[model samples]
Target: MKSLDIMIVDTPYCFAPEKLRKLLKWFFLAYIQTLT
Candidate 1:
């Protein structure tokens, strides 16, 4: 979690609503893939 926070802070563009949404969607997909 700390690493994730640092990552977000480092990537300022993630604050943009559209980019954040896409990032979250991509993260969710990656998480699901790991579960499978």
Candidate 2:
């Protein structure tokens, strides 16, 4: 949890809404791939 929090904060998109949306889209895609 701590590492995840750190990662999010360290992200260049942390304060950018457009980049954040793209980030979440890719994140979900990666997560779905893992499940498959």
Candidate 3:
């Protein structure tokens, strides 16, 4: 779980669709909650 958090934090900038970025950010926040 710690590794997953690190991976998300270490990800590079994205140039994809804006909608996709928003979705990923939401999921990422949920994931971090689990770690806490």
Q: Which candidate leads in lDDT? A: 3
- Tens-digit lDDT string for candidate 3 (1-36): 677667666665386478867876887889878879
For model 1, residues 1-36, the per-residue Cα lDDT tens digits are 456556655665546689686886687577668779
> What would the per-residue lDDT of candidate 2 be over residues 1-36, giving only the tens digit for each residue?
356546655776646689676876687577668678
TM-score of 1: 0.54
Residue 25, model 2, lDDT: 62
Q: Which candidate, 1 or 2, has the higher TM-score?
A: 1
- Model 1 ranges off by over 4 Å: 1-16
Off-target runs (Cα >4 Å) in candidate 3 are 1-13
Best by TM-score: 3
Off by over 4 Å in 2: 1-16
Ranking of predictions according to lDDT: 3, 1, 2
- Collision pairs in model 1: none
Q: lDDT, candidate 1, residue 33?
A: 80
Report residue 10 deviation for candidate 1 (angstroms): 20
